[model samples]
Target: MIIEIIGIFFLLLLSAFFSSSETAITRISDVKIYQWGESKNRKYIKAKELMNSRERVIGILLLGNNIVNILASALATSILIGLFGDKGIIYATLIMTTLIFIFSEVLPKTYAIRESEKLILYASPFIKIFIFILSPINFLVQNLVSSILNITNKETKNNDWKQNLRGAILLANNKGDVRKPDRIMLESILDLHEVKVSEIMTHRKNIEGINISENIDLIIDLALKSRFTRLPLWKDNADNIIGTLHVKDLLRARNTNTNLLINDIMQKPQFISENTSLSEQLNNFKKDTVQMAFVIDEYGDLQGLISLEDILEEIVGEIFDEFDKQIAGPEILSDKSVVVDGAMTIRDLNRSMDWKLPDEEASTIAGLVIDIAQKLPSINETIKIDKFHFTVLERQRTRITKINIKLIVID
Candidate 1:
């Protein structure tokens, strides 16, 4: 009886070892580990080439072998039962399951996850050897899987290795190894790849700039009062921004009674379209050594401007300087509508007040009215949008400019 029990114990131990081995292999195979570090790019390239082709096979084998080990445990219990009757079978089965569950599932998986990178590095040579030895079985399994995938429509030409890498990142995030801010920054950086320059630029109306014809005294006052260090100097209107002036230069010229022409103070301004990416913009800023770029439309009209600070703000949220002033929210009228600044961005308005404005030409409240009305509106000239009504409260230079707005129905 003692000998029989010992044999059963040995079989259980073997099964557990195989099970744990399967788990460890499954956990490590899909994980990527660069050979040495980033400095060893050549080694990483070789290691990657060696490991890429066999990952799916490794995963399949790990799952298949784990099942085999689990069944081995059950088979050993059955043999113990046959030889030693009900009580021995019960005891053997309980002991085998407990040992396998703890040693095979929990402990090994924990360690595999913790030392996954190191294990992948150290185990690469062995993994390659195993891949070669199991090539025949791997091919057979691959063919079977391919046939099954064909029936289920799951086969892929590309292997989607990139998604697997992202999944690993997601796994780390799910496991609480990555922090929220880090994840957000990663996502924001990725988003920069898809987003173009046009979406985030300031509009022409929002661009408060000085004309080049302005006097030095006015220019100095404007420079002194300005929040931005670099300001665009236009020829006649905002559309013809010839150059950008540095506030420091304006300060330097303060003692000189001599007239400072825009030409004299102007530095070459870089022009960028709305369609540029944030990443590309950063590169431009580095190359140009300038902090701001004028955003122009295809028609050469000044659309708005974007700054290094603006892009940085998008990444890290709003930044305020000593010159920055807090913007107040729109005044809510007694009639339930609100008086909103025409300069307020639609994005900001919608986010702040829970209003869904139409997403057409205008990003601002004033722009929206002009687009929809097709001309500047007169006082009491109302436009109904959904349940809300807009009444033109002010007009500045042929623009609806500002309005008294409210939602009257469907409250």
Candidate 2:
């Protein structure tokens, strides 16, 4: 009986180890492990290898876990049966259940959750050795699991590591491990490839450009007075972009070489399709030659301007400098009504105020209003869409320039 009891206790320790390691490994971050690998963080280097064969790692864990748990239960039952005869089955079951539940399952897993990174680092080398030794069994078990999934019409592969990463971030946020701004940035990074340049670009109407035909003094003044570091230079028409002039170059030309022509100082405009994804645009910007691109429609008509800063703003939210008075969002009045610039993107507004204004129909609040009304809204024209009310506070002949919006609860 004493020997059996000692064996049971030792098996319980093994069971606890397996249970905790299984939970920790599943929750560990592959990104963190690889980052540590880059710095030669020896403490977690083995975890990198374990993560390489995640499916196999899990198989070995379950195999070891089940073996230990069953041995412990069997040992407990035999010891109790020898002492209590026929009724020992119930007694053994209750005792083992309490002991296993408290010590082997919940308690260990709770510690694993709180210290997953540290635990995985320490345990990964041993886990890798176990996986290597039990490779044949792990392979067989994996094949059996796959066969069972197939038989039950279950999906074998999710393939969306991005969604899994997002879930991990969200889980961490809920646990207060990640702050809101950090969560936003992480989620935005995942959204970059899906978002298009047109959605975040400055509208052509709001773009400030100078005519290349303007006199040197006037051009220099415009460049200096302007808040933008880079300004588009056009020929006869605003749509006919000639090049982009940098304020630094203009100043350099003024001080050092006043003899330089506009053509000599300015860089050729980088034009991009309005439909180009932000990810592709960002890659384009990585080349040192281009800082901004003239966004054009399929017909080659100017639609807007997209800069590297614009793409970054999508990920990090609006970035402000001394020149940017209000980078994004609406002005909230004391009455709880918001006064918005018509050019404000629906996506930005939604994120700013936590509003559910749909961006699918139109990118901007003005475009949304026009789409909802089926006509160009006049000044002071009020339109109701869902629970929100939109009043066109100002308009030009061609576009809605400003709006006053309010949300009404219908109860």
lDDT of each: 0.68, 0.87
lDDT (10s digit) by residue, model 1, range 1-411: 566556555655544444444445456443443333344565455456655554564654464445555665666677778778887678777876777677656776676677654555555565566556667776777788789999998777775555675566667878999865555455455556555566667767777788878776788789778887888888766788888988888777655636556577678989987778888998899988889998877887777889888777656545788877654457887867788777666655664565778745665687788778888778778887666787888777775556778887653
Name the candidate that leads on TM-score.
2
Worst 10 residues of 1 by lDDT: 30-39
Count of steric clashes across candidates, in order: 5, 0
> lDDT tens digits, residues 1-411, model 2?
788889999999988988899999888766776686776676656678677777778889889988888998888888888889878889989999999999999999999999998888898878877787888988988899888989999856656889978998889989999987888888889988888888888889889999999899999988889999999999999889989999998898889986768999899889999889999989999965587999999998999998999888889988888898673469999989999998888877876676889787788899999999999988899999878999999888877889999998767
Cα lDDT for residue 79, model 1? Answer: 71
Candidate 1 whole-model C-alpha lDDT, 0 to 1? 0.68
Candidate 1 residue 379 Cα shift, in angstroms, is: 16
